[model samples]
Target: MINPPALTLRRRSEELFNSAERERPHKEDSAALLLFYAVECGLKSIYMLRNNLRSTDDERANAQSARSFSHNIVNLMIALNISRVSIRPAPPIVIARSGLSGHPLVLHEAWRYGEKVKDANTIYDWLASLIDWCRKNR
Candidate 1:
């Protein structure tokens, strides 16, 4: 796996976020998928930046410890010491295989398979919140 630099990851998240915004009107599922990835990249960027991981080699060394996060945004946020209270009002987005009861599944791999997604607008808002938080912290 290519563990990109923090700046690269942040840039990717921004690009994906813009793409998600464009796709929202015509293709919600696509937007959700893009939002999921955008949040993932954003979180990872913040994590790396906070941890003082600037070089590709530094990212690779830490990549093993971060591998568990994968596409799990909740886990990544927790690892970054980000609490729900920190980015409140807007909930964190989770890209999961199955919707865990109680925690509303807003985005999932089903979107990648052309499945319709629910509450995509809310997810987009959540991404905005996360991006804001990353900016403040970075």
Candidate 2:
């Protein structure tokens, strides 16, 4: 199976992006979480579509699409753009996710309002960029 319509993925992204926008001012933590999912799903959907793969329950397909599941947004972006990175600094240098599974930095709380995530802009921007790319190709 290959190249599902991806309507579900797009809808999910829209839902999460909408939720994040609505709650950004007061509930940045939860909003960031939603935005994170939005981008990840968007990227996976795009990547799968480009690769002639299905968006479904197949284990291999899921694993391929979700190769960057454990990464933070920055590392996730880096992983998505894997071909661009050349220098391998160290363990924390986070170049990709499929092989190394780089650990997320404590730069922000995953699901909590902490001092680290004072602003949701970074998360929002990343999500927005992913969504924009999806619009063009997915």
Highest lDDT among the candidates is held by which one? 1
Question: Model 1, 7-88: lDDT tens per residue?
Answer: 8888998899899889889987788788778878888887777777764346445453444466677778777878787674
Q: How well is each residue in 1-138 modelled by candidate 2, as lDDT tens digits? A: 443344666677788878878988887667766776776667666655555555533225334543434345455455456332232222232222223223334423334433334334654564566666656656
- Show where candidate 1 strays beyond 4 Å: 54-64, 88-106
RMSD of each: 4.0, 8.0
Clash totals, every prediction: 0, 0
TM-score of each: 0.75, 0.57
What is the lDDT of every predicted structure here? 0.69, 0.53
Candidate 2 least-lDDT 10 residues: 88-97
